[model samples]
Structure formats: structure tokens, C-alpha cells
Target: MSSLDAEPHAPGADAPRSPGPLLAIESSCDETAAAVIAADRSVLSSVVSSQAALHERFGGVVPEIASRAHVERILPVIREALAEANVTPTDLSAIAVVTHPGLVGSLLVGVTAAKTLAAVWDLPLIAVDHLRAHLYACRIAYGEEAFPACGLVVSGGHTNWYDCPDAVRATLIGSTIDDAAGEAFDKVARLLGLPYPGGPSVQQAAEHGDPTAVPLPRPMMNRPELAVSFSGLKTAVRYAALGNPNSPEVPAPPLGERRIADLAASFQAAAVDVLVGKCDLALKQTGRPTLLVGGGVAANRALRVGLTDLCERRGVRLCIAPMELCVDNAAMAGLAWESFERGEFAPLDCDVTPGLVRA
Candidate 1:
């Protein structure tokens, strides 16, 4: 589930469950997460250890720090997930981990652990694409109906939309030419002197301010295709909050609490507008009747509202990942079942392909 999407079942639901589950590890970024999901989609236990605190002082994720933390927490988090699920490694059908399109160091932590466990336990090893896993969160929420839909995967490292023909297939339609929306939020927040991990910070401040207070630009709006842009928008926020660096005539105003709020509201509104606007175009181009949105930024309240409104007006079906599944978590690794059944296993020597956004 995209924390940006909405789902209902609580994590680690306690009740008599399936015989075997796939143990999944997700250390693709700053979060060290593990989960046990049965073939029947029974999410026995999902655990995540975030290194947000460690990265907060740095303004963003530091690759080296994230990798080290993952090494420290992956095993413990996996142990906790198994304990909560009431299962052992031998009880799992396979070992799965997100192995691509993320920080190489962070991805390696999870991949190495999964491979070691798989080899030690004699279990099948499955590698999951980080982007596909985000899409699978929709399937975990909506079942088979989530397929043949338009998917928008928005996160810190990705802001690309796809035409998903099934759980295992996606075709890139359009994407950001520069910074992803989450990056824009972070940089804009810093411009406004807000806290790190800007999506939540900006969303919070935006609640009390007017969205129209500052006139922000929405780049690449009329480009017929689904191509999206946010770098220009972020620069616009910077100029609005701090006077143009090269200008000498006018001095930048102080960022009072209220002024910050207004700028936050305006920047968020512009970003959401472009994000939702692209979704509108994606649906038209793909001729798909459903829209599936996942990724960390999908959690933005304003973006969700905009997507809901877009689907409603277009008479399109909407399936979003639940709040718990929304952020990077193991429950979504339920997709591993598909690969396992299809006999698609990863070699122990496989390495992570970081920052590789499949075009």
C-alpha cells in the first residue's frame, strides 16, 4: 500500500493462518523492513526500522549511513517479523528481497541477507524490483482488479508513471525530467526553513495556510504526453521564498511562521496540480479505466485528495495501497508469490542495479 494510498487490515494480524509464507526484506533506502506474507496474501507480520532520525540532521539520506544502518538492523527486523508471524525461516516457502532501482549499498544489505537466508534454509530466492513492489501494493489491496491499469509510482528516487498490464508487467509512459516530487518537497521545505523529509513537513504547514497565497509555477503542463517536471517548480519556490540570488534591487523577506505556511501551501498545491494533471493525461493515453498510485509521496494528503477528485470526475476506478502498505514495507512483497510460482528465482551472485529507472 502506498502510505499515499489507503488499505485496511492491520499488520501482524493475529489469527490461525496459512501454512507457509515468504520472508521479504526491504532495505532499499533508509528503512530496514521485513515481512512474512503467505501465498494466500495473509500478511502475518510486517516490521520496519526507519533510519529517518539518523538522516534528519543531514537534510536527506546519506547512502553510506543508510547502508550501515541496514546492516545493523536487517537481521533484527527480520527476526522480529518472524517472531510476530509465529514462523521460522524453515517455515517460509521462499526468501525475497527488493534488489534493484535503489541505493546500491542499501539494496545490497537486503539482497545479501535474503541470499544468505535462502542458501542456509535451502529456500528459493526471489528478487523483486523496487518499482514493481510499489505497484504490487495495489494488488495487495485490490486483488486482481488492480491490473491493466495506469500506475503512478512517486517516491524520493522515482516519479514515473506506468501502464501496468498485470502484476508483473509495466510499460513506462512518462516521468519527471528533473527532480522527483518528494525531492522538490524536501528542497522547498529547506528553502522555507522547514524540517527535513519535506513531504510531511510541507503537508503539515500547508494545512493552516492558503494554497493560493504564493503564485508558483507548474512546469511542463501543456506537453500532451504524461511527462512531468518539478525542478522548475522547486526553483520557483526558492525564488518566491528567497529573492533571486542574482537580483540586487529587492531584498528577500523574513520567513515568519505565517509566511512559511503560505509558501508551503502554495508550493504543495502547485506540485499536486502537476502530479494529478499528469495522471489525467496518463489515463487518456493508456485508455485504462483504473489508476493505481503508490510510493512515499503518494502519501501526501493533498495529492491523494487530488487523485480522488480526478478519478471521481473521470468516472475511473481507483485502487490505492493502504496507509500501512503505502510506505516501503514487506507486506507488498506478496508479489514474490508470482515469481515463485513462475519459477523465476534470482542467482546468489545477483547484484543490485541502483538508480536504474526502467524506461
Candidate 2:
């Protein structure tokens, strides 16, 4: 019997039983996270152990390092989450884990842990898609009123659009053919000598500079399909900053604070334009009156402002997940509740799909 149907009380019992909390784990990337969420959509506790520092020197996440870190942190993170929520394994209604579209080793860390817990505790296991969880963050933030919208997951590992008819189903509509928006940010930041995890750094530097000062190409802005391409744009930034690498080294002038700021601002503006423009197309194609934006890049202030303006002009409802939920976190995996409600539990033998996505 499913956990949802495992209530012990007889039919028509005088006292109704409260739903047990669901334990969700997310180790899809560099962040190791766990959360306790009730069936009523209450997030009791959310804990994330980020490997930003470990990956900072490398400029991006290293799969082996990330997976090893997840192995070390997953148990502690899950323990803390349950403790914070005042719930134990016995108090859990089910165990949910992101099992797809991530570094294989990192995914195994979480999947193995979840399966172990599920087996030991005899709890139901629910598999969640990482990208869907990002989009589902909006639903978690806004409740049932947030769906029937266009969902975009723009982050370091993904840039994909979806037609979300409700909390449980998402139809993939468009995606990036090259670099993800957040990856572009990181590359640009590296070229400008900024810190790793470039989204925030670029946003900060752009504040003091003129966005129009630098002219960068906006790739795929006029493309026929709803797809986006950032590789060309990234190449454009490289040529602008370092000059033609194919040609002899002309003594290029140093990039001063002002110049770097302008480049950051300009690149940010161009990227935001592409994102907002694609969102416009998605909204039109799906006829979705609402637009839901999620993933790490959703935390960009400029992107938020641009999206807000676009939605206002188009008369579309916009819901951006809070900063906490914008990044990879298990709290967003509260999305598992949807599967739990439908009694869609995965067997212990279910394995991870490293690069899974809907067609």
C-alpha cells in the first residue's frame, strides 16, 4: 500500500490524522540540500551545504569534487533537516530525491542515501526532476495560483522553457543550443577577472557602469524558433575583452574598473534581453497568462526588473521564486508532493537519469 493510503485508523474515524512530513534531498550539483515539507506545502526546514568555496578556484564545479562533497554532506544535511523540523524517519510519509540531469556521481550520492533511508524506514520513494524542481519553486512560493504558466529554468547547467499546465505536468517547449545563461555569466566574469559564480559579481559591477557603453551581440534574438544561443555572445565578449586571438598580440590596453563595469552591464543587459524576449515568445506560443522564472539566474536583480517590466507591459502575471528558492535546494523539491499525492512512488531499484528531460 502507498504511504498516502497507509493510515491506520478505521474508516470514518472520529479524529482525523495529520499528514506526516516528507523528506526531500537534492544533490544534483554542487549543493547538498535536504528539506522537510508537509503535505500542506509547509516547508518545515531547508538546509543546503554549498560547495562554492571548493569549486571557486576552478572557476566552475568539478564533477568528482562535487560528488565527493555530496557524499560527505548528504547524511549530515538530511539529519539536520529532520531535526530542525522535529521529525524523525518514522515521522516521514515519504522520501523524495532528485535523480536526473546532473553529474552522475553527485546524483548517486543522494539517490543512494535516499534509497537507504527508504529501505531502512520502509518509506515511499519519489523521484523528482531537477529542472522541474527549479520551475516548481514558483509553485511552492505562490501555491496553487501560480500554474498554467510559462516556466523558464535559467541556470549554470540549464536554460529551458516549459509549458506548465499545472503543478504536476510540464511540457518542454524550448531550450538553449549552446551555453546556459548562468554559464555565460561565469565565463564573462572570468574574462573580466571577477570572482567565480559570476552572476552576482557581474550584477554588482554593472550597477556603476553604463549598460549601453559596450555593444555585445544578442544571439538568437530574431531567430525563428524559441531557442536561445549564448555561445556566440560569449565569443563576442571574449573578442571584445582580449582582442582577436587569431591575430598577433597587439598590446591591448588594460581593462580598468569603468571598462569592466560597462562590459558587465552590457553583457547582463544583452543576456536579460534574450531571456525576456524568449519568455515573450513562450508566453505567446503557450498563451500562458503567467510567467514563472526560476533557477540560479533568477536571482539576478536586473533580470528580475526586466521580467517585471515585460510582464507588466504584456499583461502577464509574473512569479519569481524568492532568492532562497532560486538556487538549487531541497525545499523546492517539495515538488515531490505532487507525485506523492498521485501515489507515484518509485521502486528501490529505480536508478538515476544523469541528463533527463522531457521532449
CA lDDT of every candidate? 0.86, 0.89
Best by TM-score: 2
Model 1 per-residue lDDT tens digits across residues 82-151 = 8899876646778899988889899998999888777767677898888888888989888888888999
Each candidate structure's TM-score, on Cα atoms with residue i matched to residue i, is 0.93, 0.94
Candidate 2 local distance difference test against the native: 0.89
* Error at 112, model 1, angstroms: 0.8
Model 2 lDDT per residue over 1-359, tens place: 33222333233434556769899999999999999999988899999998999999888999999999999999889878887998766577889999998999999999999998887777789999999899888888898999899999999999999999998889899999989999999999999999988998999999999999878888998776999999998887787777767764774446889889988999999999999999988998999989999999999999999999999999999999999999899999999999988889999999999985674
Tell me the spans in candidate 2 whose CA falls farther than 4 Å from its real position: 1-16, 246-253
Top candidate on lDDT is 2
Q: What's the CA RMSD for each of the models?
A: 6.7, 4.0
Worst 10 residues of 1 by lDDT: 1-10
